[model samples]
Target: MLGIKTVFTEMLGIDYPIIGAPMFLVSYEELAVAVSRAGGLGTIPLPNYRTLADLKKALESIRKATDKPIGVNIHLSGKFPWKEQLALCLDYGVRFFLTALGDPRLIANEVHACGGKVFAGVVSLEQGLRARNCGVDGLVAVGAGGGGHCGSIPALILVPYLKEKVGLPVIAAGGISTGAQMAAAIAVGACAVIVGTRLIATSEARAAQAYKDAVIAAGPEDIVVTDRITGNPASWLAKSIEKVEKQPQLGSKRWLDIWSAGQSVAQVGEIKPAGEIIKDMAREYSEVCRCLKNTLVP
Candidate 1:
C-alpha cells in the first residue's frame, strides 16, 4: 500500500490523499464503496438519489461495504431538498461533506456540531475566501478543465494561489487523471486531488456504457466549456454540445443524455475497476516522486 501523508489524508483518516469527486449522476454507492475500500475518500452527490429513502439505502449499502471514511456531496443550490438530505446524512453518521453551488454557512454549523468536516467546492479566490469565512475545513479548487462547473484558472495556478490567499487545505481538481499530475498538484501546495472524469470511466461508475466510451474516445481538444447544459459554465464533450444544439426541445434536461467530461478524458484509456485505478495511481505517484527526487538539483 502506498501512503502519501498530507493534511487531507490525516484529516480524513485515509491512506491516499485522493478523493473520488462527487459527480452528479455518475457517483453512487458502488463507486463510493470501491474508492473508500481502496483507501481513498469516495463521495456520492445527494441529488443522485430521487428520494430520501433512496439516499438512505445508498448510504446503508456504502456502510455495508466499507467502514472507512466516506463523504457526501450536498448541493446548496436550493433546487433540491438539501436540508432533509443533510439531516439524513447526519443521522447516518456521515462525517465528511463536500458542498457546492451555494453558501456553506447554512450547513457548516450543523455539520460541525456533529464533529464532521465540510469542504466547499470553489472556483475563485472570492469563493474560497467566502467559504473559509463560512467555517469550511477545506476547499476543492475546481479550476478550468474540470468536469462540470469550473473556473477560468488552471489547477496548477489555482491550487497554489488558493493556498496562499485562503490559507486552507486545498484540493486541486481539473485536468488531473494520472499519478504524475497528482504529484504535480501536491508539489504546488494542494493537500489532495479530486478526480472526476477519470473515475467516470471506471467499472464501478454508474454512468452509462456509452458515456464511458465517449470519455475514452475523447481528447483534451474534445472538451468545451458551455452554459448550454445548466446555464452555468460547465465542461462537456464537444459531441454532447453538438447533440444539445441539434435538439432544442430537451432544454437543460438534455444533459441527461449528453455527457459532461473534463480534459482528463484524454488519459482514460479503458474501463478499469475503481480499486485498480486508485492502486495504480498510488503506485505511479510513488514512482513519479522517486524519479523527481533523483532529478532535483543538488
Candidate 2:
C-alpha cells in the first residue's frame, strides 16, 4: 500500500492525509468506519443524529467496527444541542472534532482539555485567523466548488493562501476528487484533502441511490452555487435546483431531495465501496507523484 504522510495524518494518527469530509445527511457510522478502516480519517456529522442516544449508538457502532481514528462534525451555529452533543462525544472518548459555522473557542478549549484536536472549517483568511485565535488545532479550508457552504476562493489559491497566512495545518476541501488533485493540494502546502462529493458516490455513504446516481450524472456545468436552500451559498446539482424552483412548497424538506454536490461530481463515474475509494485515491496519489517526478526532472 502506498502511504502518504502529512501533519494531518500525524496529528490524527491516520495513515493517509485524507478525511472523508463530513456531509449532513450523507456521512454516518458506516461511511466513517469504512474510510477509517481504509487508512483515512472518517467523521460523522453531529446533526445527522436527532438525539444524544442516537449519536451515542452511532459512535459505539463505529468503535466496534474499527479502532482507527474517527471524528465528529459539529455545526456550531445549528440549533441542535451541540453543547450536550460535544459532552457526550467527549465522554465516549472521541479525540477529534470538525466544527463549522460558529465560534470554536469553547469547543476548542473543551476538546483540548481532554488532549483532543478540533479542526474548524473556514472559507477565508479572516475566518481562518478567527479559528486560530479561538484555539482550533487546524483548519478545513472550504474553498470554491465545495459541495456545502463554501467560499469564493479556489482551493489552488485558498490552500496556499491559508497555509501562508494562518500558519495552521490546512485540510484542503473543494474541487478535489482524484488522486492527482489530492497531490496538487499537498503540493500547494495543504496538510490534507477532504473528500466530500466524491465520497457521496461511495457505496458506504448513506445517501439515497437516486442521489448517488444524480451525482454520477452531474458535470461541472451541472453544478450551481446558490443560497436558496440553506441560506448559505452552497453548490447543488442544477437538476435539484430546478426541482426546488418548480415546487417551492417543499420548504424545509427541500434539502431531502435537493442534492448538494461539488464541481468534482464531474469526476465521479460510479459507485464503489468507501474503502475502495480511499485505496484508489492513495494509489492514484502515488502514481501521480511518480509521474510528476519523471516528467519534471527530465
Candidate 3:
C-alpha cells in the first residue's frame, strides 16, 4: 500500500519508485526520456555510446525531450573514460547516477559534491555494504534473476538482507515487471524497484526487432545465465546461447546480435511504447495499493 512518497522517489524527484534499468545498447535517449516523462526514472547507459560525442548528443536529446530529472548508468569496466563520462553527464544535468562493476567511492564523492545522488548496482550483500562505505546515497540490489550482470541471490532474500545491513534506500532489481511485483518488492522493504527486461520490449528501446521478438517469445525457462558475452555471469536467452557460442570472437556481429533478458519477460505480452508501459504500471500500482489498503482495514 506504499504510495509515491518513498525515500527513493523523493530523492529522485520521481512520481513512481521505479527505474528503467539501463541496458548496454538497449537503453538510449528516446527510451530514457519516455520513462522519465511517464513518472519513472529513465536511465542512459554509458556503454551505449560509441564515443564522447555520441554521449553528448544523446544527453542533449534527452534534455530536449524531457524536463524531468534523468539518470545515467556507468559500468566501471575501465574500458571507457569514467571520469570524463561523469563530467559530461554532470554538465548535461544528470542528477542521479548508477554505478556497477567497480569501486564507487570516487564517483560517489564527486557526485555528492555536486548535489547528485549515487546508487551502486550491487549483486550481493558484500557489494551493498561496500557501496555504502563508498558513501553512495543508495543501493540497487540486483538479484540473481536480473538481466545483465546479476547476483547469485534472489530478490526476495537480497532486498531484506540489504535493508537490514546496508542502512540505505534499496532499489530491488530482478524478477520485477508488474505492479504486483513492485508491491512485492516494497513489501520486502525495498524503497523502489528497477525493471530492465520488460523495458527492452518497449518501442522506444534500441534493441533490434529480432531481439525484442526473442524476448517476447521467451518464458521464465528461456532465461539463462552465461559468461560467454562479457566474460562475466549475465542473464541471456537460452535460444540465443547457441548462436552466441558459434561466434568466433566475442565482438563478432553474430555475438552482438545475441539478446539478453530477465525471467520477467515471460509476463510481457506485447511491445508497447515506454510511456505507455510506465503509465500502465503506475495505474496498476495505485490499484494494487488500494486493494492492499482495503485488506488492512479488514
Candidate number with greatest TM-score: 2
Off by over 4 Å in 3: 1-3, 246-251, 296-298
Model 1 lDDT per residue over 140-220, tens place: 999899998888899999999999999989999998888899999999999999999999999889999989999999999
* lDDT tens digits, residue span 1-298, model 3: 3347788888878888889889988989999999999899999889889899999998888888888989998876688788899999999889999987687886877788777999888888888887888888888888988888878899979999998988888889998999888888988999988899999998999999989989998898998887877899899898887776777586647757777898898788899998888878777888888888989753
lDDT of 2: 0.89
lDDT leader: 1
Q: Would you estimate the TM-scores of all the predictions?
A: 0.96, 0.96, 0.94
Q: Model 1 compared with the native: what TM-score? A: 0.96
Q: Count of backbone clashes for each model? A: 0, 0, 0
Pairs that collide, model 3: none
Query: Once model 3 is optimally superposed onto the true structure by TM-score, how far is the C-alpha of residue 268 displaced, in angstroms?
Result: 0.8
Q: Which residue pairs show collisions in model 1?
A: none
Give the whole-model CA lDDT for all candidates, comma-separated: 0.90, 0.89, 0.87
RMSD (Cα, Å) for all candidates, in order, is: 1.5, 1.4, 2.0
Instruction: In model 1, state the lDDT of residue 224.
Output: 89
Candidate 2 lDDT, tens digit per residue, 162-281? 889999899899988889999999999999999999999988899999999999998999999989777989998889878877997888788698899999998999999999988899
Model 1 per-residue lDDT at 258: 79
